[model samples]
Structures are given as C-alpha cells and as structure tokens.
Target chain A: MWCQSCREEYEERDAGTCKECYEEASETEEELKREIDDLKSKVAFLRLVSPLDLISTTDLLLHAAGSSSNANPNSSPSTALPCTPAVPAHRAVLISRSPVFKAMLENEMEESRSGIIKIYDVSYDVLRSFVSYLYTAEVLLDEHMACELLILAEKYQVKHLKIFCEKFMTSKVNNENAIGNYAFAHRHNAKQLLEAALSLIMDNMATLTEREEYKELVEKDPRLVVEIYESYLTRQVNTAAKDSTLQP
Target chain B: MWCQSCREEYEERDAGTCKECYEEASETEEELKREIDDLKSKVAFLRLVSPLDLISTTDLLLHAAGSSSNANPNSSPSTALPCTPAVPAHRAVLISRSPVFKAMLENEMEESRSGIIKIYDVSYDVLRSFVSYLYTAEVLLDEHMACELLILAEKYQVKHLKIFCEKFMTSKVNNENAIGNYAFAHRHNAKQLLEAALSLIMDNMATLTEREEYKELVEKDPRLVVEIYESYLTRQVNTAAKDSTLQP
Candidate 1:
C-alpha cells in the first residue's frame, strides 16, 4: 500500500498510522505551527527597545562597580565612577524587570536617590548585557557570558534570565566542562544544569577522577563532589535493582 | 496491518505514513511545540510591569482629554486636570513602545515639558487599556475597545497593537456588523479587517442594498460603495471564467 504522507509504497508491517489518524496529526501540526507564529509576533511586540539603544531617553544609569579607583570617593555618584562608561537604563524598566532593582529603587536607597546604580562584582560588558536582556529578553551568549550573566541573574533573582543562562550552559556541557559546570550549577542552585552536568560526569566516571577540573572540584567543593558521587551510586543501585527484577 | 499510532488494525487502502515518516513528523511537532514554549517564555520575560500597577515609579502622566473641568488651567501637572485621574506612565516605556510618543517626548515638546500628555478623542478607560497594552502587549479586547485601540495604535504607529486589534476586529466580523466594520477598517487602513468585512459583505450582497448600514455608507462615502460593487463584479467574472474553464 502507498503511504499517504510521502506517497511511497510500504510493506504492511511498516505501517505508521491509519488514514484518519494521519489526517488528524497533520491538522494538529498545522495548528501548532500557527500557534508558534502567533507567539513569535507576541514576543516581537512585547520586546521593548533597549534603553542603551536610545540616545537620550535614559532616566537611570548603571555603573559597573570597581571599574577604577575613585579619586574623590566622597564626591557625587556622577563624578565617582570615573573609568567605565555607564550602561544607561530607565527606572521603570529596571524596577519592572528585577525584584532586586525594584526593592533598591523603590525604597529610599542611595541608588534611587542618586539615579546611579552601581552594580558590584560585575564587568561593564556583562552589566550592559544584563540590562539589555531585561528590555529585549535577548542576548548573544558564549559560555563565559552565560556563566557571568547566570551569576548576576541569580543575585538579582531574575528567574527568566537565570533559566536562559542555565539552558545555554546545559547545552554546552561536555565531558571536559561537566565537573566545573556541575560545581557552578550547584553554587547557583541551577537544578537542570546540575542534572545535565552530573549525568555527563557519570557517563565518564572512570576518567573523572583523573581530570584536573575534577581534582580542583574535589579540593574546592568537596560537598558538591560528594553529592555527585551520591547521585551516581543511586543511579547504579536503581539499574541493579531493575536488572535483578528481570531474573524472575 | 497494525497502525503504529493508534495500534488499530487497518485495511491496506487505509494506510497512512510509513513508520520512518511518522517518526520524523512526530519529531517536527515536538520541535515546534518546544519553539512555542521558548517564544512564550521570551514574551513573558519581555512584558514589563505596567506603570499604573506600580505606585510612585511613574515619570509621565497620560491624561484622557476632555474628561471634565480643567479647574486650574495653569496649575502644575501634579495638580492639573482635576476631573479625571491621569493614567500614570513611564517615559522610557512610552518612547520604546510608540514612535509617536518617542518623537513627542524626546524633543522639547509641550508634553515632555509638562510631563502631561493629553490623549485627545480617547476616553479614560480606552486610553488606560492602550497604555497597559503598550507595557504588557495584552488587554481584554471587545469590539468597541478594539476599534478605539486600533485607531490609537495607528495614530501612534504601534504596529503590533494595531495588528492585534485588527485581528480581534476581523475575527468579530459577521453579517450584522460587516458593513460598519468594513468602513471602520477602511478608515484605519486595517487590511485584514477590511478583507474579512468585505468578504462578509460580498457573501450577503443579496440583502446588502436593503440594509440601513449600506444606505448610510452610500450617503456618507459613495467611493467605498462603488469599490464594493467593483469587487463583487470582479469576483463574479472570475467565478464565471473558472467555471467555463472547468467545463472542458
């Protein structure tokens, strides 16, 4: 009989679905594609123009803290951050996007009063990308940028950006980076990344002990290393139990 | 043969896709659903908190024009327009979402100077919904609200909101309101709504001339009526030609 979808002859044993079911599947596929298109348009609509792109509309400025030595540390904020150019932002955008920013700006805080929010423990480039992501929900991520932004996202409690960074890191996980990523994920509370990294580490457990990163992890974060071994042992026990049940 | 998908026995003639093709299609469907999920999260992340919802973060005030008494005409913006409570907004959000607002606010315009933008010919509720849609890309749209917002969107060059309102209005097109929607769509340059309304109008041409809306449309805009007739004639000619071609 001819397969309705590809219009090619197939053996009776190689049948997929009945004609009615096939038609229903095709309809469902079409509906799903339509929904994707609608969702894409919504995303485009909802994405606000990054304040950094606008020349003159910024209501707040974010300075990368520790950019340089403050010559006159007691001076006004505008004069204090003398090295790195600030990542200009809007107050409304900041407060709306990050709960950390919301609390910092809404209260009678120094950042709110001065209109110059100094983001600490972050580089100028990463700070800019973080602010831009808040507006557009987009970023060009390499492994390094993803890790940095994930840390910042975690600090600021931006769940969406944290998930985005975690997904990227998870996808980039390999045998070489698995232990390191596993440690990072544990520190950041990234459950998905932790699972992915742990799984990768488990698959190469024979060589894991010899890897330099694994040694470093064992030294720096023995608790995380212990957790990984625990997970591996649990998986092994689960497999052994299943294999034993087959003896019946 | 046993159908792989419903696990039902089927006759040879009722065969659908081959097993390989079925699996590929299933994978494509899963990929599409995953894409939809990603786009949805992007949209959620990009959506800003409406300034109205957050107290004391607003930097701009959008007042619905012609609400009532302007009480103290020359009063400060904080005290001006005593009748209608202004829909508070953020300048950055307004500029990013609408080019019209950007141009009005970025330059040393009157609205920018006073920080009170008077949206003329719009009611308080519609203006509020319009502002809310800019921030969130969402609003509970009914026919009247959609029409009002469509006009506002067009005037402000918010293409996303315009398309959204047009889609809503088009879906609502029917025999009863086809003529009215057609006219509104024409005025607003809403192509989708215009086509939907025009198609409905064409389908009901037998009673078109007798309708009160048709009579009013003819009196108000004879050109639009002429265009409708032209479209109906063109459709009839095309149908006749196609029917004749099929006869062979």
Candidate 2:
C-alpha cells in the first residue's frame, strides 16, 4: 500500500505492520533524511533560478521564463510565477513636487521669459512641467504657459507640441486680453499669435478709446492708425460701390 | 568842354577838335578810335566778371548811366563799359536734353544685376513716382508700382516706403481681390499684407463656401476651418457668459 500524502510505500495486514516493516522503518528514517536532502537541493535550485532578489526583478522574471521554455520542450503545465512589483505612481508625483522642480516649472510658465526656455538645458520649472505632464497626462497651460510652451516645444523639436500650444494661445487672444497677448506674440515673434492679436485689436478699435493708455503706441506707430483708417475707408468705398451697382 | 558821349580832353578855344576843319575831323576820328578801344576792353572785363553774359550786359548798361548807386557784393560794379552780347538760354536747355543726361538717369534707375534695387538706386519708373509726388504733392501710388516699389524699398532698408506699400496693399485686400493680394503678400513675406488677407478671408468665409474656386484652399488648410469656428464660438461664449452674469 502507498501513503498518498507522503508518497511512501508500506506493507499492511490486520495490524498494518510486518517483520520487514520494523527493519524498513529504521531504513525509512534514513530514506526520510535523503528525501529531506533532496528537498533542500530543490530549494537551492529555486533560489538560483528565481528573480525576486535581482536588481531588476521584472528583467529577471522575463529571463527565467524564457530560459525555462527553452530548457523543457514537453514538460507538464507549470503554474504562473509572481512578477516584480510595478513602479509606484507617487514617485513621479514626489519628483514633480521637489523645490527645484517647482522653481523650474514657475520660470517656464512665466510669459515674459518666453522663447528663452530650452527644455533639454532648461531651468527647473520646465522640467517639472514635463515630468508632471508625463506622469499625470494633464497639461496645465494657462495663457502664459501656452506662450512659453510653444517656445519650449519648438526648442525641443516637438512639432505636435508646438501646434497644441499655438492652438491654446490663439484662442486666448480675444478683444479683452489682446493687448497682453500681443505683447507675448511680439516678444516671441509668433506669427500666428500676432495675426490673432491684430484681428482682435482691429475688431475692438472703435471701443478702445481709453486714449491715454494707447496714445503713445498709436503715435509711435502711426502706420497702425493709418492701417485701420485705410481699411475702414476701403470697406466703406466697396460697400458704396456695391450698393450703387446693386441699385440698378 | 568834354563831350559826354566821347569823354575826350579838349582845348578851351578849339573845344575837343583842331582849328582846321580837316584837322577837327581828324581829331574827332582819333577821339572815336580811342573810345572804341576803351569799349572793347570794357566788354572783355565784363565778360570775365559775370557768369551770365545777358546779366553782365544789363549790369554794364545800368552802371554806365551814373544814376544807379547799387553795388553787387559778388562782383565789382560794371566800370562804365560797353556791353557784350548775351549768351542764348537755348544752350543750357540743349545740354539738359542731351542723350547723356537721359542715359545717366536710366543707369541710376536700372535694377542691379545682383537683383537688389536699393531704394536709393531704384529706376526712373519707380523714382518718377517719388518725383511726381514731390512736384504735385500727391500720394497716388499705382497698385503694380506700389508692389514693385515695396520690394525695392525693403531691399534698400526704406521702412517708410515699405510702410506706405503695406498701407496701400492693406486697403486693396477685400473679398473681390483677396486671392491675388494674398499671393502677393506671401511672395513678399509682408506681415501686414498677410494679416489684411486673413481678415478679408475671415470676413468672407461664408461666401467662400459658395465659391467653388476656394474649396480647394479651405480643404488644404484645415486651420482655416478651426479659425472661423473658434472665432464664432468665442463671440457666442462671451455673449452668453455676459448675459448669464447680468441675469442675477
């Protein structure tokens, strides 16, 4: 008879014992010792093959699985092994929260420093923004960030990033905020931003009669005044001519 | 007695002539010969002093009367001398109309072989506009001339000229002529012109859909669609926000 739990052989009668059983029991102790030794060897083998203690546990696990498949072509099915733990999400957050990162992000977000942010060799604020974006997938761009990030995008040679920034900044330059936006556009030499600013300024020209504020601007750049007047005159002339032609 | 016309020294009894009638006639002839010599010297002296022979002749006539007291600081008063014949004004006009003078003007106006027409070195056709403006105090700049002259102006660092051209082009950019003006603006990289074109395009965006000719343009630059839609949305959003805020 065989013991199912221990996988050991035994002889059984009414008493479940024999003369050979007594002698075999003494020898069974020695066999048990040998079995314990075999178990120890298996434990040693598992320790050598397992990746839990490796520098990169994920890399070790992948290596071990690949090696095992290569070693046994027709082995019985094996249980899935545990993998290395994933990188913590808070680590990225902690890095972005550093004082250095905060300063760098703040500097990059400032509109006045636009076109001067070089991401690869950038100050701490820009790096923080980049890290934050990567970790959270959240783009925190206000008007200032939108302008600065366009420059950063161009600096980093990221075409899609620049387009996204430009889209955001263009939307911000309305009649109310156009003057400040125009300043940023002029500082960075942003063509699209300038065009948007011009349109907003032109649209609101009639209402921007806070003469003292923009008087010097208009005086210094008389061409701007001339442009507005000429455009107005042109429209009036065209409308009159059109009306006359339509009257017939 | 002295003859006022002759200015000859005379003996009192014989007057200005000899006792014999034949001698008197001879004496008169001698006096006349001496007067002719004095006149010839006077004419030569007058020609040396005056730039214009006609003016010199008039000076001599006036000074010989002894009635004129005016003295020219530029030249000594004519010494009661015979006048010289005036040089014709036709000579000055003839020189001005010469082929050499025309050639010099043409050379000054020709575009440099280097493809740069400095505002200072622009050809007669372009310069004729400036000259005409100077003479008539008019600001009539033809469309084609304005465009070509702008290129010359930009090349020569003439900011005023460029501004003038931009103002002219801006006035011309309307729905009916925007396409041509847009092409010109792009060619010259004229920022003002481009802005004008953009404004015209935006204003006429609805009509553009009706025109089959501009369908390809709208398709090629999808941003055009975004610009129009966003502009409309912005106006709506602002109006809605204002109304909602005011409702309280």
Candidate 3:
C-alpha cells in the first residue's frame, strides 16, 4: 500500500492512521499554525516600545551597581560601574512588568520618591537588557546572559522571563558545565535546569569527581554534591527493577 | 491493519502514513502546542495592569465627546458624555500604544499641554473600552461594540485593535447585516470585513433589492452600491468561464 503522507510504498502492518484520520490531522495542524501566526502578531502588537529606544519620554533611571561601586545607591549613577550609564525607563512600564517594581513605585519606596533605582551586582548591559525585556518581552540571550537574566528575573518575580532563561540554559547544559549549572540551578530554584544538569552529571559519573568545578562545588557546597550521588543511586535501583521485570 | 490513531481496523487501500511518520507528526503537534502555551504565558505576563484598576497614578484624562457636547473639547469633561466619567490613563502608555497619541503628546499639542484628550463623536462606554484595550489588548465584544470599537480603532490608527474588531465583525456577517456591514466595512477600509460582507451580499443577491439596508445604502452612498453590483457581475463572469472550460 502507498502511504498518503510520504507517497511511498509501505507494508500494511507498518501503516499508521487511516486516510480520514490523516486528513483530519492535517487540518488540525494547519489550524494550529494559523493560531500561532495570530498569536505572534498579537505579541508583536502588544509589545511596548522599549525605553532603550526612546530616552526622551523616560520618567525613571536605573543604575547598575557593579562590583566596584560596592552596591551602594549613594554612589554616583555613572560611577557605579566602570563608566556604566544609567538605563532610562518609564515608571509605568516598570510597574506594569514587575510586581516588585509595582510595589516599590506604588507604595512610595525611596526608589520611587527619588525617580531612580539601583540594581546591585549587575553589569550595565545586563541591567539594560533586563529593563528592555520588561517592555518588549524580548532579549537576545547567550548562556551567560540567560544565567544573569534568570537571577534578575527570579529576584523580581518575573516568572515568564525566568522560564525563558531556564529553557535556554537547559538546552545548553552539557558534561563540561553540568556540575556548575547544577549548583547554580540549586541556588536559583530552577527545577528543570537542575534536573537536566543532574542527568548530564550522572551520565558522565566516571569523571564527575575529577573536574575542577566538581572539586570546587564539593569544597563550597557538599550537600548538593551528596544529592547528586543520592540521585545516581536511585537511578541505578530503578534500572535494576526495570531489568528484573523485563526478565519475565 | 489497525489504524494507530483511531485503533480501528482499516483496509490497506485506506492507509495514511507509516508508523515512523505518524510518531514524528504527533511529536510535532505536541511541540506546537507547547509553543502555543509559552506564547500565551508571555502574552499574559506582558499585559499591563489596566489603569481602571489603579487610577491614582494616572497622568492624563480622556473625555468622550458625546452627542450633547457636539464634539467640543471646551465643554466640561463630565458634562460632555451624559454624565460619563473621564477615562484616566498614563501618558506613557497612551504614547506607546498609538502613534496619533504619541504625536499629540510629544509635539507640544494642546492636548499635551492640558494633559486631557477629548475624543470626538464617541460615547463614554466606547471610549472606556478603547482605552482599556490599549492597556490589556483584550475586550469583550458584542456586534454593536465591535462596530463602534472598529470605528474608534481605525480613527486612532490602532491597527491591531482594528484587525481584531474586523475579524469579529466579519464572523458576524449574515443575510440580515450584510448590506449595512458592507457599507460600514467599505467606509472604514476594512478589506477582510468588506470581502466577507460582499460575499454574503452576493449570496443573497436575489433578495438584495428588497432589504431596507440595501435601499438606504444606495441612497446614502451610490458609489459603494455600484461597486457591489460590479463585484457580483465579475463573479458571474468568472463562473461562466470556468463552466465553459469544463465542458470541453
């Protein structure tokens, strides 16, 4: 028989759906694609013009308190970083995007009263990207950027951006960075990243004790290292059970 | 053979895809659904807290120019719209959502100076829905609301809301509303609604002359009435051409 989809000869035993089902599935796929296109346009339309693109209308300024600034709001906004500039933003946009910002602004926090916010332990570029994401729900994220943004997203309770960053970081997890990522994930409460990193760590268990990151992790956080070993033991026990059941 | 999708027996002649292709297609559908979920959350996250919910921080007021006010900005804001209250909005949000508002606010226009915009020839309810949509990209639309909002959307050049209203209006086009909707769509430059209305109008051409809307439209705008007849004539010509070719 000929397969309607691939238009190739196939054995009847190897057949999948019937023609009616196939036609219905194709229609469903097309409808789903149309929905996706509609949603994409909606997202684009709903996106606010990023304040980074329009500085003249700004109502607030965000300074990145880099390491050298000692994370002090009292330090000059420009002097906070290695010549890092303050990111101009609108109060309404910041309030709309983050509940933390909403509370800060609406409750008359010092940041709101002063019309400036100082984000500690973030670089100028990351701070800028973070603010840009608030308005646009978009950012071009590398692994490093994803990690940095995830921390900021977490601190601000920006769940959508945190999930986006975690997805990216999970996809980039590998043997080389699994332990470090696993430790970072544990600290940041990233469940998916933790799971992915742990799976990679277990798959490369033979060299887990040898890596410099692993050694550093053991010295700094022995509990997380023990949890990895515990997970590996559980995996072994589950495998043995599956093997025993297959023997029947 | 068994149909994998329906779990029913089918003849080889009715086969669709091979098992491998079926599995791949199922996976693709799942991935598309996951993507849709992600986009939905992104939309939700980006949605602003409607100013109606928290009116204190509002920076601008919009008064609907109801019929009594004669579309005058000088009248008392409340007295303009049958005791309709002004719609509070943030200037930043208004500027971001509409280029017309951006120009009015950014170019030192009178509306910018007064921080009050009086929208002409619209009721208070319609004006409120319009401003709410600007914040949330959402609205509950009945036929009348859809039509009213479409006009407001087009006048303000809110393309997203206009398209949204057009889609709703198009879906509601029927034998009863076709002629009226056609005229409305044509006036608003709503191509999709115009086509849908035109198609419905053609489908009921035998009864078109009897409809009151058809006569009123002919009296109101003879050019649009002539265009509808011309379109119906073109459709007839095309059908006749196809029939003649098929006979060979």
Model 1 chain A: worst 10 consecutive residues (lDDT sum): A67-76
Writing each residue's lDDT as its tens digit, candidate 2 over A98-212 gives 3332243345454113312222323344444543332222367887666666665564444444655776899777776766566556666676877787677767777765744
TM-score of chain B of each: 0.92, 0.36, 0.94
* Residue A70 in candidate 2, Cα distance off native in Å: 63
Model 2 lDDT tens row, B1-248: 33222444333332221123223334545665554544333222111112132231111111111112533232335643222222211111111222332232234333212212222333445654532321112246778878876775565344445666787888877787775566567667788887777667667766866754356546665554565557656766988999999996
Report, to 2 decimal places, the DockQ of model 1: 0.70
Scored by DockQ, the top model is: 1
Task: lDDT for model 1, please.
Answer: 0.87
Tens-digit lDDT string for candidate 1 (A76-154)? 5665563778898888777888899999988999989988888776778999899989988999999999999999999
Encode model 3's per-residue lDDT on A132-193: one tens digit a residue.
89998999999999999999999998888999999999999998999999999999999999
Once model 1 is optimally superposed onto the true structure by TM-score, how far is the C-alpha of residue B112 displaced, in angstroms? 2.2
Tens-place lDDT per residue, model 1, B1-248, is 88888988988888889998899889998999899888888888888887766757677888877534443443356854536678998887888788999899989999999888988777789999999998898999999999999989999999989998899989999899999999998998999999999999999899999999999999999999999999999999999999999996
Residue A43, model 3, lDDT: 88
Worst 10 residues of 2 chain B by lDDT: B56-65
Residue-level lDDT for B111 in candidate 1: 91
